[model samples]
Target: MLKILATADIHSPRFLDLFIKSLNKVKIRPDLIILAGDLVDKNNIYALKHVYEILINKYEEIPIISVFGNEEYRGFENKYREMYPVFKWLDDEYIILEMKELKIGIIGTRGALDKPTPWQSRHMPWLYNYYRELPLKISAMIDEARSKGAKYIFLVSHYGVTYKNLEGEPRNIWPYLASSRMEKIIKDKKIDLVIHGHTHNGVRDKINIDGVEVYNVSLPARREVVLIDFTPKSKVFGLEKWLYSGG
Candidate 1:
């Protein structure tokens, strides 16, 4: 089974340091590392690159997949890309990761907010096209990934794809947190595992839309690096005891 370490909304390099230290203490090395976005507090290329270097240094040879969050897009995305040209930046991307025994397809995007929630503030007219079109584009990406014959499909984004993962966030900010259109696509696509951050709510909530599991892996939310095993017929018996919140 390939072990994956997933984290999101790191916001600072300090969290990465602590996370690495904690991993060392436990003697756990992951086969893959996925960052769900918000690598820095501010959208500075230097700041984001600094954090990226720290991550690469700690987890050498492990494939890392990352996306830009709302914070990263606050400035010019091109500037950020120019700094780290070699990294797997998966904002609007479909890629395949081939392991010795596992083939996984990753579909990623920095999801846009659709003003479906009642409390959302109005966005500018120029940005209207994005709010309307991003969901469809992202959904198409997921379909393309699945068509490529991946044993496991991981759909990742910066915005919450379902309201189930945004429990702790205020209702007023719900519109800013995720899109109902994305949620519908996720359920329709029947992806294996959907991951996202942005909302700092914990892993205490999950959106099981038609048995598709969606998790929020934000650092402030999960408070710990998430560990997942993709070996067939495997289970972490003792650990899954009480993580579920509802009956």
Candidate 2:
């Protein structure tokens, strides 16, 4: 079985000490950790690095996967990435982790988020360029992962993929929160699970796209790191309730 711990919109390192302790309390040592985005507060590049270092020190053997949030790109995306060489920065790309008996493929990107309908306003063109062209690029990455013989696929992004997970946010900004294009990709990608952050005000929303499960793991949404399990032969993948809510 493969165990994964996922969180998002963790804007600071204040909760990490407790977070690490909680993991120990649960007796779950995750093989993989996924951080969706907003890892730092504002433009404080140092904060992201400092928190990441703590994670590296604590889980030295674990593989950490991450993507950049809109805030991370405020100025530190490039610089912050260069500072952390121990982690996997999988923005707009794919990686295959070959487990003993199964292979897990992950395709990640910040994701495009243009409005789906004409009623919604167009916005965030500054970040929208990626929100514009990333879908097609991400599709290729997904295809590439399948070609590499991945048994399961995880689609990680810093933006929401569907409107279902973006509920509770202002209706006016729906277009800026996630892209319809990404949802279109979900239909074809056959993703086993979709994980993303950015919707802090939203619930721990779970939506089904075709057959794939999409989860919004924003810090506020989950209130803790969520542990997910996957059986190699049975191919069962889902949240396993091995965590606590952050205070």
Candidate 3:
């Protein structure tokens, strides 16, 4: 069985204690830890060290992979990557893991939005074009991973992919929050599983989009580190016992 522990939107050290408490309760050590995004609160560079140290202390050699969030900002991506050499950061890129019989390929990104947010429009006008082209780039990357003999594919993003998980979020802002464009690629590419964050009020933690199971591992919403078990037989066990509503 392949075990993956995932959580996101930690934002800053404010959620560090909750995250650490949750980790202590996990009896089975996961093979991998995935941070979807937003580790720091608005690019609080110093606070990010605490987050990394806590995980490193608990799971020394376990590989930790991550994508950037809005808080990480745009131009500072290189800075974050250089600062934290411990994490394998993916920006619309992929990494393949060989776990016994299963070869897992994970593609991570900050994700795209159908409509740019007001702040994005005013501050980063280039995003208007970037979002349009990201899905195509992601599709090519998926093909590249498959050619490399990746049996199982995982799509990890910082933004929601399906509206089904955004029930509690206002409908008007849904386009700004995520991209239906990327969702199309997910369906077309036959993605095995999708893990994402950035939706704090998302009521549905998990949903299926055209047979692909999508998980919202936002820390503020789920209030616990989400554990996923994938077996060689293609059976999946999502340990919901570890998850509870924050409200």
User: Using lDDT as the measure, what is the rank order of every candidate, best first?
Assistant: 3, 2, 1
- CA deviation > 4 Å runs, candidate 2: 13-26, 74-76, 115-129, 232-247
Residue range 13-75, candidate 3, lDDT tens digits: 778888877777777788888999998887887889988888888888898999999989878
For residues 31-129, write the lDDT of model 1, one tens digit per residue.
887788887776655766656776678778888888888768644767767887656888688799898666688987887776633323344454557
- Model 3, which residues run further than 4 Å from truth? 234-247
Error of 1 at 195 (Å): 0.9
Could you give candidate 2's per-residue lDDT for residues 118-200 as a string of tens digits? 32235433554555678888888877888889878889998888887777898888877888788888888767888898888
User: Residue 219 error for model 2, in Å?
Assistant: 0.9
Which of the numbered candidates is closest to the native, going by highest TM-score? 3
Q: Report the number of the highest-lDDT candidate.
A: 3
For model 1, the local distance difference test gives: 0.70
Query: How far out, in Å, is residue 94 in model 2?
Result: 1.4
Is candidate 1 or 2 superior in TM-score?
Answer: 2
Model 1 residue 247 distance off true place after TM-score fit, in angstroms: 31
Backbone collision count in every prediction? 0, 3, 0
Give the lowest summed-lDDT range of ten residues in model 2: 116-125
Q: Which ten residues in a row have the lowest lDDT in candidate 1?
A: 235-244
TM-score of each: 0.82, 0.84, 0.93
